[model samples]
Target: MSQDRDEASAGPQPAEPERGGGAATSSGPTDDDGALAPGAIPEDEVAPRSKSRWAFARELTVIVVIALVLSFLVKTFLAQPFFIPSASMESTLDIGDRIIVSKFTPQHSPLHRGDIVVFEDPKTWGSVPQHRSLLKRVVNDSLVFVGILPGGGDHVVKRIIGMPGDHVVCSLACSTKAGPLTVNGVPITEPYIDKGSVPSTTPFNITVPADKVWVMGDNRNDSADSRFHDGTSHGKLGSVPMSDITGQVVAIAWPISRIHAMKDYSNVFAKVPKP
Candidate 1:
């Protein structure tokens, strides 16, 4: 009995640990009172995460600024791309050929004869419009967006054959039957006409209206240019407005070997007779 009492009373029996669920806590600094202190984070886990987020934001901002600056530059003075879709100017510019056009020159300079130009298609050039694919658009726009790719808004490139206020006639009767175009009754020699295409077939002569030009393709037989669209003495058919002229092709930039500056028509037109 004594031994039993000694064992039981030797120390106050440890009270059964109170049964309860585990306590919820976030790792943080402990206060003097042993409670979590606010605003304290473990450096091991949170520090790296915070640093990563900050770095990511900074990088994103830098990339956005660079993109904006590049876009502005591209839209400004830099070279831009345009694709040839038709064979109207064939043998010189083929389908799938990409050319670099001079946007700045045409704005300040006069459009000269023989300048291979890209223009906003006058309703006279026909209804077709050129454009690039979605993927191509994304790539082009992401790099630099001067204008829409695939050349939106009815754009076509052709050679300028006649200038304003000139009496322009095709198939001037040569010895046999017909010859090249006659401006003011004087024959102008065209050396750039596509290799095999003849001078002219359909004949129509008209004085070009003021502030407008008569355009024709080098591939005379294969092209439907101002000559084909001209209306009879009965009515007016195809005539491009001077305002629709876009820009003259300054050079062929791509396919490096073929890269060469375009020959200005001024040299040839210098010899043409004035009305």
Candidate 2:
């Protein structure tokens, strides 16, 4: 019996389990499954996250506005879109081709012969027939003013054939084969013109007036250019004033398959004497 009592008191036998099936732990912030309790987020961190999001949005808005303003300014002063509307330019430029005309080049340098140029239609020249209604016209013009569209009313594109004081003449019988088109007593070979198209169908002889330029389309048969207005006043109809020039077309940008630089014909006109 004394031995049994010694074994019973040996180091403190395992304590009886708590009243529950398993031993209970000290109470604290925990679920029955032992997951931690949710704590309140700091007010400082919450406000900063919200403010940061708003700040990012504001910065994005500022950047977008700046980009649009820069684009408008560049289109207005440096270069702008130009679209070919008719077949007058033919093999050189096709209808629906988009081009970029450089306003800066014409501003700094004198206009040269053989340069494809965009100009304002002279008052006496016939207006390009527009099939749109009045409302459509107004909307189109508004878009152009805001730098959205390429061209507006009263704008025409042609190749420069004569400058001030140039004496230009063409065959009376519609024959480029018969050595047509002479400028300042020098014959001009226009390889840009379409095959089978004569230099001119009607007779014409004119000396470009002072401070003016004579322009013609490559598709001579279809073009109503300086050749059509020969019977009118010297400076008023047959020639465009230097101030009327908008820009020189440097490149065709649209229709990815047809992308190309508008070639300058300086070599073709090299032998012609300046008038």
Candidate 3:
């Protein structure tokens, strides 16, 4: 009776829980405070972070590729950027000025007489070929191809003075004593010509042929334009083929102070009758 009373005082022993199937396993290694230890995250948890990083990288790549393609398409068919390398079109487009040319003008829109055009070198036009290291050329070409850099060297920009079938004439002694440039027998007043410059120092009379145009620069005295190339060795290299035109200068794109839409001077050519 005493022993039974003592056992009752000691209280009953606790039952042992079953192992294996019913056992509770820890999710991962833990520190003293029961928080997951550094680098002790489960493989499944870590995999998601890795996958997210890869996904981000892939998405960025896709976006960059898409942007490049759009830029190329815009440059190819919509518009392109160019920088003035010389003073040929100065006062209007100074050296180091950047401009945007619209391909739509040549492709879809009717080109007007006063339009400023960009075209390939019709007869080399006295442009000296630049010598560049192969690596430099590759880098520059790639940038130009992608529309990230403005095109230069192989193209020239000038104002169209005579379109197809126009009888253009610049009178004798093309110096300070030069005569007014007449188109279709009408003298056109040009207010865009550079200060202290004459119409031209070289005189010529030529009727622009079909699918060709006579172009001149705003800086008349400094420009070696259609007049200089009028009677080249290649014969009448002054007239640029319409097919060679890349586009028309639509706006000045750089030199924030000079940012403005290009003027076509339609009124200047308004009175000149079409041939």
Highest lDDT model number: 3
The digit string of per-residue lDDT tens for model 3 on 1-275 reads 99998988996789675555433343575567766544355545556777899999999999999999999999999999999999989899999999999999888998998899999887535557789999999999898888989998888999999999899887875455456888999987788989888888776788888888899999998987787777743215788888989999999989999999997699999999879
Residue-level error in angstroms, candidate 2, position 159: 0.1
TM-score of 1: 0.68
Please, what is the whole-model Cα lDDT of each candidate in the order they appear? 0.68, 0.80, 0.85
TM-score of 3: 0.81
Candidate ranking under lDDT, highest first, comes to: 3, 2, 1
Candidate 1 overall lDDT versus native: 0.68
**Which segments of model 1 are wrong by more than 4 Å?**
1-69, 76-79, 125-153, 172-178, 233-236
Candidate 1 residue-wise lDDT, 1-275, digit = tens: 99998898897777563334322234665678765545445545556777999999999999988877765565455445678767778788877777877767467778776778777777754666547899966786555353334342357777877777778776546312356677777777888777877766666777777777778788777877777777673113455677886667877766777787776667777877666
Candidate 2 differs from the real structure by a C-alpha RMSD in angstroms, to one decimal, of 9.6
By TM-score, the candidates rank as 3, 2, 1
Question: What clash count does candidate 2 reach?
Answer: 0
Q: List the residue pairs that clash in candidate 1.
A: 113-265, 130-150, 131-150, 132-150
User: Candidate 3: which stretches are off by over 4 Å?
Assistant: 1-43, 48-52, 124-127, 232-235
How many clashing pairs in candidate 1? Answer: 4
Model 1, residue 221: distance off in Å is 1.2
Query: How many clashing pairs per prediction, in order?
Result: 4, 0, 0
For candidate 2, lDDT tens digit of each residue in 33-131?
A: 855334423334445677889999999999977876776787778888878888888988889999888887578878888999998888667666668
